[model samples]
Target chain A: MATESGTSTRFRSQTADFDAETGLAVDAALAGLDALDIPTTQRRPLASRAWAATWPKIGALALFLLLWQLVVWSGWKPSYVLPGPGKALSEFGSRLGTSHFWDALARTLVRAVEGYALAVVIGVVVGVAVSRSTILRTAVGSFITALQTMPSIVWFPLAILLFKLSESAIMFVVVLGAAPSVANGVIYGVDYVPPLLVRVGRSMGASGFSLYRYVVAPAALPSVLAGLKQGWAFAWRSLMAGELLVIVPGHPSVGADLQNSRELLDTVGVMASMITIFVVGVVVDAAFNTADQRMRVRRGLVAEGTSAVRAARGSRGLGVAGGAVDPVGSSGDGTMPPPADPGAGGGDGGHSGGAG
Target chain B: MTAVRSDTAVRIDGVSRFFGSGAARVQALDNVSLDVRSGEFLCLLGASGCGKSTLLGLITGLDAPTTGTVDTTNRRAGMMFQDSALLPWLTAGGNIEVPLRLRGIRRGERRERVERLLAMVRLAGLADKRPHELSGGMRQRVSLARAFAQEADILCMDEPFGALDAMTRDLLHDELERIWRETGVTVIFVTHDVREAVRLGDRIVLLSSRPGRVAEVFDVDIERPRRIDSARVAELATVVTTRLREEVGRHGH
Candidate 1:
């Protein structure tokens, strides 16, 4: 018994030493790999990356302005009908200094935020509900798609009739237009969560709300975010349409200013208002794009560098490629393949066959 | 055969599972019964359609038997799948903490347990690394740590290392044997690899496919820390392979 105990102790210590040595070896190898000029796919500094991303967008805007100026010079229409780029820029510069323009912008933004928030809440609730129940899904799944396909303009007339040309009318149209898309996003996202993950969660004793909260929600996040982005675009469009159709007495909006400019034949003001709306849309979309990019980066779904760097890494095959590695034990010595009778077997035969 | 010994971690009595309905109904398990003894590493060996994973599902309570009863004596079983199935959004440490959090373990205690489990899996100081950042072997080690975190008496592993390379699999076998010996957890491991069964199992239960039923049970009686490539493992694996081939041949008609 004394000899046995001593032997066991010695064996235990030996194994511990072996493990520590392996750890050190792995660390050293990793350090070596880092030190080597393997041309790491490290991203550029944030400032440079931002500059790289922004310059093209600025160039596109300048090109668009130049094209407009050229179109005016060619007399595509009279300057009164299609104002020159200079006339529009001057009008925009003048509008930028006015408190009225700022107020109008703020009101439009507030209304968009309010309507979009309402749509998001409704969309998520409906989406989760529909995804969870086959009955609900069957009843309204196609109906939601149909609603999304219906133009936001179609809802404005009904909303105006219902709310009598108030701010609520605009909000109602916006919500109707955006909510369906958001709900569909949630449904699609929830539907696409891998069955393996769901089984894993269930095996871990998670059920009902806990399962949805912990497993389903996180897994479905990318899809949900995509849906939210689409919903915001719909909401913005619906809000603009509503503002043009129904002028709320207290709500000074960009759409109202556009209408006023059109009525007074101040074509440059109309163009400036249109530009302001376009810029606002682009800015909001940029915010959503940034959020999406951040999520993708966190998940390692997207490379951490500019496209040029990614392309370089791809060509050189220097970066860590996606996909699970081949089995470490595989010696290329062919083992007996799994039995090929599908009717009599589980589905893992193909998986093991490929590995072998 | 032993009248459901008190030490049995899992008891499946005359259980049969059938999938689909009417014309499509396929019998996956046919009147199969097994009693996994506590603290024994038992391997369920079978061909592809032999209901190995299905039996594991029943044992883990992920699925119920169409007939008969699967009794676990209210003991929770932690299961590891072929795929790591670690939550992609979580860090390695965060993944390990999942079951503990599910069990309502306090944050401080959970963190401590996560550290200890990671160390046990030889993945120390990798708590904050995301799943994608880790290699396949490392990810699986994190998964093993997560399975251990459930603190359950029984561990059900369905080809957990089947996807790994041979070298990694061998290393993990040593790691698993070590942990199993230390923890004394009743492990019901399912695998098709004959050598793997010989290397790890205290006793191996072989199953025939096409309405999977028990073909034979062999007590390895081999000493601990058996190497997969060792002569003893190879000899035993040859015998098991002969029987497995015979079982497959019977279905050839």
Candidate 2:
């Protein structure tokens, strides 16, 4: 009996220790948070995080440019075959100043956006349709996987035959390449969603559309976003491939420019065209990366340093609310133990605790 | 077989659940009969594949017993699981409001009730916080709050706190005891934890593996807010552990 009381007393003091450690951690975190500048209503971390995220990519770009300049100066290949960073930049600027270059760039940009947007819309719709139904998921899922595995360039010949080598034909190829990726993404996202989450939704009486909206869709967002990123890569690559193969008269898309440069053996223009495509791909990838990081940060999955602080704040809030009824001194009934582990008493700590 | 009293909230009579057919056929639950009293905290203790969870699933209307009737008078029943199961996308308050919303509670009233329950779980300020924002213990608390908010007469938990660490599980025990006392709701909790069964249950029912059937049932005379190291809890825990060990031992033999 005396030992039991001693254990309770020790437990109470341990609770106090936890609260104190939490409080100290929170104070330090709040101090660190002073640097974070997270807005009260803001879903995302402060501007500093965004700035930090961009800096590395910017540094990498600078490094790449430096390396390219070095390679050019070293005569790694002939000057025309491999232009220096300075020459490329000058050529890019010269192209930028011309109406012809602008027209070509504009046409390519429009096509890329059109194809990408079409893929996203069709992909998401078809993906969701396929994922939600077992029959569709089973029947078309294999086909979608097959399409995704096959190279986009393979579809260029088929696309030319289908649309008679027109701009619309190129868009069709891009859609074919990207839609499978998007659909597959949605399928995988829905598949991977934590079963606990689905059960929770059911317990809450959410089923059918309400359940999907409230639980499934949001839970699958990160994976769906990943699929969207993959889809974008496919769309961009397919568009470039289609453009190179299908030479349209009186129009100057990047793919067409590449073909023209190659025909004339203007290796500089071919390299320039390739560089433009690479830069665009890099920029799009960076944008998606930023979005993914922001989502994770908002969910508190990343940035573990702030966890104790947030938890401490929650405890403080609890303490303040309970104070009116129980008062501060009586709050030591040891009922609240500063957010300790709920599954601790189970023999093993490795039980399935949360959602997928 | 002991005759079940009429005051039973749950009565499983002559239930036999079989999986597969022919040579592969397996009887998950064979000729099981049990009575769970109204407002009683009954823990269904069993090993993996002992059909404890399958039994709970049948009771919750998620599955059907192949050869028996599960009668609960159509009372609103809520089920919790080993996982907190709180939606990562939903805030604690939002999760709690789900059952209420489903029952067609007015938006204002749902919000008010969710607010009250959040405070009850001591998660008042964290109403706007998502599940991912919560710690493991906090998430389970939110889950418990959500389960209670369902306003069900019978709450079925499948090792609800099984994933938590020792300290948080103990604290939740206190919290659950407080809630159970205040609500007087009937609870059918399932777990493999011997001590947890002793700590929370009014009656502990141990089921044997391979064609699961009731091995033993012990009535715990422990009072509310029972401490982990309480003599009564330890004593009952010892009795149940011994019975469970013997049951498991018989299988190995």
Give the true-contact fraction for every prediction, in order. Answer: 0.22, 0.19
Model 1 spans > 4 angstroms off: A1-41, A306-356, B1-5
DockQ leader: 1
Q: Report the lDDT tens digits of candidate 1 across residue range A1-356.
A: 01121223544555565556554554454334324512334666778766656676777789998998999999979888998889898889999999999999999999999999999999999999999899999999889988877777877668778889899998898898789878987887887687888898888888988898788898887667767877887788888878888898877999899888888998988899998998897777668767755655555554553222354345522222211111111111111111112211111122111110
Give the C-alpha miss distance for residue B221 in model 1, angstroms: 2.4
- Residue lDDT tens for model 2, A1-356: 01121223434444454445443453354334323422233234446545544566677779999988888888779987777777667776677788887788789899988988888898889888998789987788889877776777887677789888699888888888778777777777787666667766776677899888888887777667767877777777778888888878887888898889989988777777777878787677667756754554455443322222333454311111101111011111111111112111111122111100
| TM-score of chain A for the candidates in order shown | 0.79, 0.69
Model 2, stretches more than 4 Å misplaced? A1-55, A76-81, A97-102, A125-139, A261-268, A304-356, B1-7, B101-106
| lDDT score for residue A282 of model 1 | 74
Clashes of each: 11, 9
* Candidate 1 docking band: acceptable
lDDT of each residue in B113-202, candidate 1, tens digit only: 999998887778889987766766777788888888887677899999899878678777877876775566778999999999999998
TM-score of each: 0.86, 0.77
